[model samples]
Target: MQDIPELENCRLCEWQCGVNRLEGELGVCRIGRPKVASAVLHPAPPQSYTIFLSGCNFRCLGCQNWSIAHFPDTNETPRGYVEPECLGEEAYDVVNSREGKFLGADRIFFSGGSPTPSLPYVEQVVREARKIGDIKVNYDTNGFLTVDSLKRVIEFTDSITFDIKAYHDDVHRALTGAPVEPVLRNARYLAENAREKLWEFRILLIPKISVGEIKPLVDYISGIDPTLPLNFLAFRPNFVLENYKGASKELMEKAVRMAKEGGLENVDWSGRVGLPGRLSEKTSDKYENKGGEIAGGIAKEAGCVTHPRNCVACELEHECPIKNYRPAKKSI
Candidate 1:
């Protein structure tokens, strides 16, 4: 934050791996350099020119972008390496595109395996982008940054989409391969010091590991300030959890209720469905799966088919959870 010049002992993320990234030493991310995976105009919420960087500190079983996030030991030539200035310029052009300038795209989102590992590069991009024209930066983070790095992030970025995977430390470790302290610290820091820059705190509602975590997380945030915004991302079956069905509308409703009862305000999730029946029963009816879970057809009828993490430009994006969640008439 003040002047983290060399990567001799990288303490960028919460891992504190202490590996010398400058000397070809790799940390848990398995990447020693700033290698990006892809960049595109994403229309998730307010559309953003999202940049995805390679490597992550967490090894989540439900990683949606595992293909890029977890890089295998391959002999092929590596790609997706771009200078920070070029990326910043490209983002500036996309946000100010002539054909449709006002379609709610106003920010350049730094996403990844997690942005913590690319603090220097991302900050440079933010600076370069702002130099060209008025630009806004949003960090889609896992909230594992150190206090100093977070201070620098607050100095530059306009808003942050902070992630809180689990509330309990043991459950958090079991789910994400990381402790819950750093995320909790950063979230509390933002709520207390930089509330204006805090866009929202997000939690992925995993079926067994994290569904029950919603209440504790809500209570923690309520302890800080119930007015802080929280978004519950219904878990999409991905990677190791592929066979499992996504979090049901009923479960998330209970989550919402708990949060509201805990005195939280502004609670919303990604796509809404169901008519009082639980995800395990009734809804599937004639077309139940062999395991009695929600089948593809039933999910399609309800609006989501266990959404993929990044569903940009897909034909059926209208029904995807990452893009939209149509609430029931009563809830609306």
Candidate 2:
């Protein structure tokens, strides 16, 4: 594997820890070299060969793909260090295969724990893949990237599926273990500047957990441009929130209505609904926001030692129990 010299002073995401990833110094993401957890020919919209990258910058409590997201901390053995050119060529072949065409596949999707941590590697892969053929590329992101990093993403990706976990700072922090400002900022940047490349702004509605975020989030997005595509994802119980109730069909419908009412012209909802589970009794009175309190409580129960869940600033950044948490339940 070739070294990214920039990894010597890595500042790929908002954390900007400046750690030498090549020399094994860890940052909030804790990934040194980018590794592929897996790759599959997915049948979802914008269907393509989905490349799951290992490791993430956020310690999201209800992470559906926790094993891949937590990576080294979670005992996940990734397909360690495929040469960028090799993986890129593989992605090209996979997306252009007969199986890919039968599934309506049209692009190579780069998803992860969150792709921000592996931006350089992804960029390199795109370069190599495009060299093989005119392969379209889609980037699925958590929207926690820095301004410069987001710019690079927009430059390379044919389309982007951006995730906005929550709108309010407190709720966002508690849910994702990171601040919401950067994510919102990046979302705004995309909507205002690169709307054509944005596939959609995906908001996962986790019943009581993220219900409150819809109105404010819709307002924020519509305020920028009501025509910007927005999708409400029905959250399933997973990771630390494994026992938490999944979003109901009624709630998903209501979310779409709420977004449309809030002036979002292109609003819709999707995902499996109503898988059985109970809401968490654990909750913190520390946060002013109800959603934050609930999510913060779950994070606490899962051994996250920080209130407000600032993983980048927390003393346990390297030794984070949330990153190493082994959930008893796996929703999938």
Candidate 3:
């Protein structure tokens, strides 16, 4: 592991809050140095195997991981503070568990409030994870990263899930307190360089606010490359924005149609409205009782399910994680 300064202060993202992360220096994201809420080799609600990181750059008022992303102090006490080497060891152990052994996931996802903000540490983790296993690292980001930093980590990542909060600059700024230019630039760069690496562009469709915004964004993405997979996310009110209503079924459909109309192909409407996955179900009785267990079981089963249709027809499949399913047992 590269031994650099102890991140006495970090300015990795747009926030540029040069506070010493190691010394528990609180920044806008409300995090003190390498604070990780939880790290486990679990099947994500989206049905994909993932490793989650904590901390962020922007302060979206409606952040789902408010505890981890917005207020890092509210949760469990911070544990052994170490460098990226420690994270790598932890990740290896998680991914190699009995369940991880079954999935044999080549992909290691870097997810968080805004992973870009912690590029230094994240890159360290990715470098270490790669050495331990033949893994294709992926970044789940808000696309607010600096181009320089983005380029640095791009080498370590095989693919990226870039979030375009809104197409319209004003709306984007309003929703994320940031402009859309950086996101657009990063998306274009990634598409140009990693076109064949499964660059899934996602946009959260919020009620009323995202209707007009969808068309322009879709049009922009279509211009980028019609084959680029566009995922229209169904916004849910989970954390700080509990009072805000979720995107209605109608609105989500309209957004999907708009993407198609904008000339984008390979669009996946399975996020919520079209196909119901463990993460997408809002109030189904089946989901209420079995969603958590099913999600857990699927992850544990690893390499046991195949075919996207199974996920599509399962009544709980929203964004199947295994790409084109390989093979595995049914959820226990």
Candidate 4:
């Protein structure tokens, strides 16, 4: 373990916890060694096996995978320890298997707990896997890794699925227990240097908690490259934020509209489209103008089908004017 290329004083993420993980010391990310929570063949995005690593650099209050991300590093056996050679061999077999090829599961995704903690191990897996098949690797990250680590990651992975939690420093720290500047730095660096390999950016709108984070976040990413695939995910209340309601369809639609207004060319959203308020994203479905016919009366008067009461909080409220309307008029 001491011989592994672990940072003497860890500087993997912006936290710079500097705890020397090679000696089996824990930092805020809380993993002394590279540990994986689970590995499953995800039959989506052209099929891939997703390795969910344990421990996260940022302790997000609303994290859905807290059990895994915030788990104790006491027993690595539960959190499987697959060395590069064996893990890579398994991955190669999985991808090249008849079932894998038929199902289009030709890639591997290294996800987290923010993959930053397990980056060295992940890279090793990528190297070993390539020996068997030229398997593409998708690195799913929270965008908090240091610029140097990100460059090394880009060397092995084919694409990145990055997450942007918020734009400002204070809000980000309050929400994720980390500052936002490091995320922004890595984002811009990736855009400037590895733009083509940036597969997509994922943003979660945490209803009342993080509604304020969407616009500025969108503006910054749009500035970098509007063509970059930006996906807005609806937040499901979980972990510390379990009491709060999930995001709404109306909220997501407003978000989509704002993203378009911010000059983002490739924009989309995922989650269920249910009633006007307090909707849940647990229902997996693409966004649709399902509320188009339901728009009328209050909805028409507010120039929105949802007629959401959080007007001041909504960045798009100014785009619509209040006016008396005839019946059956629906504004999407």
Best candidate (score: TM-score): 2
lDDT of each: 0.69, 0.90, 0.59, 0.68
User: Relative to the unseen true structure, what is the C-alpha lDDT of residue 158 in candidate 4, on a scale of 0 to 100?
Assistant: 83
Better of 1 and 3 by lDDT: 1
RMSD of 3: 13.8
Error of 3 at 40 (Å): 2.0
Where is model 1 poorest over a 10-residue stretch in terms of lDDT? Answer: 323-332
Better of 1 and 3 by TM-score: 1
Stretches of candidate 3 above 4 Å error?
Answer: 1-9, 18-27, 45-49, 73-83, 101-104, 271-332
In model 4, which regions exceed 4 Å deviation?
A: 1-3, 44-46, 73-77, 273-332
Candidate with top lDDT is 2
Error of 3 at 62 (Å): 2.3
Task: Compose the digit string of candidate 4's lDDT tens values, residues 1-332.
Answer: 21456655777876676778777665667667777788878875636888888877765655766666665632323446778888888888887788778778868888877789778888888888988768888988898888889999888888888888777555564456465788899988988899988888888886654577778888898888888888888876555444446678888999999999999999989865442334332211111112111112223333432222222233332242221112131211
In what order do the candidates fall by lDDT, top score first? 2, 1, 4, 3
Q: Per-residue alpha-carbon lDDT of model 1 for 17-135, expressed as tens digits?
A: 78887677766665677777788788887478888877676655557776555543322233566777788898898988852266678889888777778788888888889889998
Pairs with steric clashes in candidate 1: 271-325
Give the TM-score comparing model 4 with the true structure, all chains together.
Answer: 0.79
- The model with the greater TM-score, 3 or 4, is 4
List the lowest-lDDT window of 10 residues for candidate 2: 323-332
User: Backbone clashes per model, in order?
Assistant: 1, 0, 13, 1
- Model 2 clash pairs are none
